[model samples]
Target: MKLEFHCWKCAKGTPGRRVTAPFNDSSVYRFECAQGHVYEIVLAQLRFEVLAETGMQALVDGYYRDAVASFAAALERVYQLYCEIVALSRDIDETVFKSTWKLVASQSERQLGMFIGLYMLENGDVPPQLPKKFVEFRNKVIHQGLFPAENDAVDFGQAVVNLVQPLLNSMMPRYTQEIEAFMIRHFENAEGAGRSDRNKHRVFFDFILQFDTEADDWDPAPADLSAELVARRSREIAD
Candidate 1:
């Protein structure tokens, strides 16, 4: 997945020099257009959100296998995010937490176990589990090189949405402070890692699954899988 940004100067009704940038963990991105204009952006969405969006896009474009893989990866990333917030609440130093997490980072099953243990410890209940059938479907697509039909991909995507969106909504009230702290640290780390002396402009992006926790009415829109696919297809055609 990649992000596209219009050059700040070129976006003013001029022939826009759209810059395409690689998608990575860093929120801070610096891109130079063909005209030698540079644009730096601060993407506000978390990695999981972007992964979900990438899955949606892949589904829309009929890359069913890729869609399933991305959605599965997004689900694992959600677990990592939950564990990170819990660590913040426990006052675990970021460096120590990261180094410790690295031990299990390469293995998704270990990450899932870590998240389940931590969630049960804090909430006294196990986190929701993905359907066994869906897990098998994902494995078939990801490991067995299966090319699923569009409906199958949509079903997988919706399953992920059903699990992730509500999980995030529930966490907001319970971990508002930790979530905010995570966001602050998220941006700080991104900026710090991409630090440069050159003058740069910063822009925040609104992503497909991003929620505004600061709003009084914090209801998130329902991600109707079929409708979302149709709308995305329409937008692509219109573009």
Candidate 2:
């Protein structure tokens, strides 16, 4: 995955350096323009959102296997985020939480188990499980190296969207404070890492599946890959 941004120093009536950076685990991205101006941009979108966007792009480009892998990864990352938010609610120390996460970090099955347990405990309701068909599809694509067709890839992406959207809506209202706290910590870490008097810091938040709690009537588009692609491309043209 990659992100493109215009350089801050060269943004007048002239064209600015359009810097592109590969998306890694870190939210802070540093870029130096052709004119030697440096920038530190902290991406505010969570990891899951970025992964989902990458999956969508892959699907659009006909990389079906890569699409499935990225969508599956997005689901796992959201599970981790859910666990982290739950821990934050309980006033858990970040260090201890990181240590606990290490036990399951390398194993996605263990992470899923953690998320299920936490959701049940917090919500007092059974969390939604990935349908068996989707599970088999994911296992085939990820473990057995199956190259899915475009329709199958779209179905898998839709399944992920169906599962994640409700979870996001629920979490937004129930854990608003915790979510805000997490974002604050995220920006603080990014700023601290890239701290410099000479460098300008900027925060960017552009998630494909974002929810606006403040909006009175904001219905998300249906979980259709084709519709999503059209809408995304439309937005790109507008920008």
Candidate 3:
């Protein structure tokens, strides 16, 4: 299916048409803007949003098992997105990032909770307890083959949404500018110097991050700025 994606170059929506190649079983797609910039769609990140939406719908339809599984998949994608942003921001070596991600990705849901706790501490954000609760509920459903209550699925789905919304709002514009600058620098370096294989590579929009003004208010409390509260929140997550 053709999907409408935002072109970072044009800052507008462009259609990404699907292309099927016989040589590869997986489907490929491309988006080209009027400015002659082309992009490849990253399917995995797109799938995360799809699954998240499906989970919410399934919860409403009373498909609790499917809802739990879909939410779990979406949560995993969230971690991947977080890692990618961190790596890019820190300018971590690609090889080292991959090696570290391998170990982090192999962790169980409980371990992910702890990792998130540390992550939030480092970022000076209070870690919400809902993510850990969702992970625990998902683990029960997956490992124990137990069904979650409809309310449990609903709560998990909402929690995941809550966790992702603000993150996307703060990161998307920064990353957009970063990628654009990187591309411009890359092309400038290659100009008149003879084109290399690197010049042929296109920048793809792996994920779409947007903010909703109508979504739940995420106002920070005055106490949130206090060092004592930050310490207390960190300790609360740890315990």
Model 2 per-residue lDDT tens digits across residues 82-191 = 99989999999999999999999999899999999999999899998789999999999999989899899989998898888878877887888898889888767766
Q: Taking the tens digit of each residue's C-alpha lDDT, what string does model 3 give over 160-218? A: 66666656555555565543443354345434243232233332332222222223533
Regions of candidate 3 where Cα sits further than 4 Å from its true position: 1-47, 109-118, 129-133, 173-239
In model 1, the number of clashes is: 0
Residue 57 of model 1 has an lDDT of 79
Candidate 1 vs 2: which has more lDDT? 1
Top-TM-score candidate index: 1
By lDDT rank, best first, the candidates go 1, 2, 3
TM-score of 3: 0.52
Alpha carbon RMSD to native, model 1: 2.3
The Cα local distance difference test for each model comes to: 0.82, 0.81, 0.53
Q: Encode model 1's per-residue lDDT on 160-207: one tens digit a residue.
A: 888888888888888899998898777776666665775444455655
**Residue pairs with backbone overlap in model 2:** none
> Residue 154 of candidate 2: its Cα lDDT?
85
